[model samples]
Target: MRTRPTTATAAAAALTATAALLLTGCGGSDSEDSGKDKIAGADTGASASASPSLSSSDDGIERPEVSLPEGDNLIFAPETTGDAKADAVLKDNAEYLRSIDEAIGKQNPKSEAVAFYSKDSAYLGSVEWISGFVKDGVTVTGTVRYFDRKVSFSKDGSAGLVYCADESKGYTKDVKTGKVNVTEASKDSYVLYNDRLRKNDKGVWQTTKSTSDRGSEVCQP
Candidate 1:
């Protein structure tokens, strides 16, 4: 099991879990954050114990206190099913990532992913959803990873939905170069305050203002 921090205050697990968000291919490999260069023959299969608290907890990282938001936000519950709309969104995101990998020339593609969302917040693998994941000028063509939907929140659902998305992703140019079997991962698990769903002026379900990001600047080209 790979665990990474939500931020600077959170650093229990290493960056391997989020690697899929940061990857491509066809395996149950987890994704990462930093220290990838040091990973050699790292086994990234599923962990025997699966707990969201443990999964999201990156022990030792500093957890700074922050103020909660006051506004209508979407939250997820335990039995949320997939709809034609949401599934399309998720599939599109997968395609978008393939383009990024092509740009970087990644090899040995593999990933496992999930998505979750609500009227207010959207989650990508237990992380807060944000717009603009990619850096400027990248012209990303698909959506990012979508996590599974959560039906219940222990608290007020201040955070968004939960996800176990495929954040693993990275690449190297030459196959002959000596390298460690390090995985790549990245994600910000938290909350996006005061998110709202907006409709286009024509009254269509335009994706510009969904609580979950359809696209934005979270990643770089």
Candidate 2:
């Protein structure tokens, strides 16, 4: 049976175009039935040190104003667990994933990958894989929305978080020639990611392991 693509490594490759598997952008009009969502609300002017802002989402939630590179539009909505520990894990997880996505979109994987990934071979090795994409001049352009995140803490000071990603608007293109390889949207376009994380001495959550399941029906939520 196929292995990596059946899990998170394949999911990462599909989103970033590193696993040698190309995913066509899943383009469709937004519908409530689709369960596809957009992040809402703006930063509440809380100090940057304030993480896991448990502010209730409302009609006045202003979208954070940040410059997104063209062809890359990833929107991360706020976490609303009201549980500090859970919020901390989710917050760090979102930032870590965003850092990697931005690095790939900007073609600067080296610096970004090193910053989030652990020194362990599995996680760090993924960075090496991503570096190859940068070396090949691949640029990812599209939108991936992450949702339905759940965090479980372990007694060993480690944690695991699972989330679903909708990659309906992302694709890989060649930077030099502006050539793009697009494919028909498949079940694989919808994915679920399981990430294993541990905080280092610096209080930073580092990705120790990750896996993905493509076309996971559970992720549709």
Candidate 3:
């Protein structure tokens, strides 16, 4: 599910979804401008389906202490559920996926990650996939660590998370062929994200339906 096509009519409309299992190919450039950059409506595909088994016991649950991102190479894996309102709705679901990587690393034309999503959030279809890499100039710089967060709540309010992602030193830079690419790591680069949250009426825990598997051996690293 690695679909890359910043244009040419989004590579001919992603070749008719080529059997549908997309997501994974963020950061794009090289636009021939048929205009359609899509990288979000959330469906990071290719799921061989095998991720429901996490329960190593966090029963005491109180985690929430991971804020690193100022370069230690990003890493977040403190999961919880001692039930402080479901751990503050999973710490606002990891700060709404770190506010969409801080609005695609500050390209911010209007991304506060849409205040934690839920307008039918697949993270708000990544706001036109981060504005087509901020309109082809480039602005997604590195680090997207997250790891092993499993969360699961339901009294019918519904909630779910299945995180793990390394993004191997994440990258994106073609501001005119300075070309960087990077996001490779392998064993399928340890990735998995299966969210579905719900709790909005101002209560917030937003995110609504998301999917991604992209090479998971239970998210290796």
Question: Which candidate achieves the best lDDT against the true structure?
Answer: 2
How displaced is residue 180 in candidate 3, in Å?
1.7
What does the lDDT read for residue 101 in candidate 1?
35
What ordering of candidates by lDDT runs from best to worst? 2, 3, 1
- For each candidate, C-alpha RMSD in Å? 20.0, 13.0, 17.8
lDDT tens digits, residue span 4-86, model 3: 11112323233223212222222122122111222353322111122222222244322222232233234576556476765
| Model 1 RMSD in angstroms | 20.0
Which parts of model 2 are misplaced by more than 4 Å?
1-68
1 against 3, candidate with superior TM-score? 3
State TM-scores per candidate.
0.24, 0.63, 0.29
lDDT of each: 0.23, 0.52, 0.49
User: How big is the RMSD of model 2?
Assistant: 13.0
63 Cα displacement, candidate 2 (Å): 21
Q: Which has the higher TM-score value, candidate number 2 or candidate number 3?
A: 2
**Candidate 1 lDDT:** 0.23
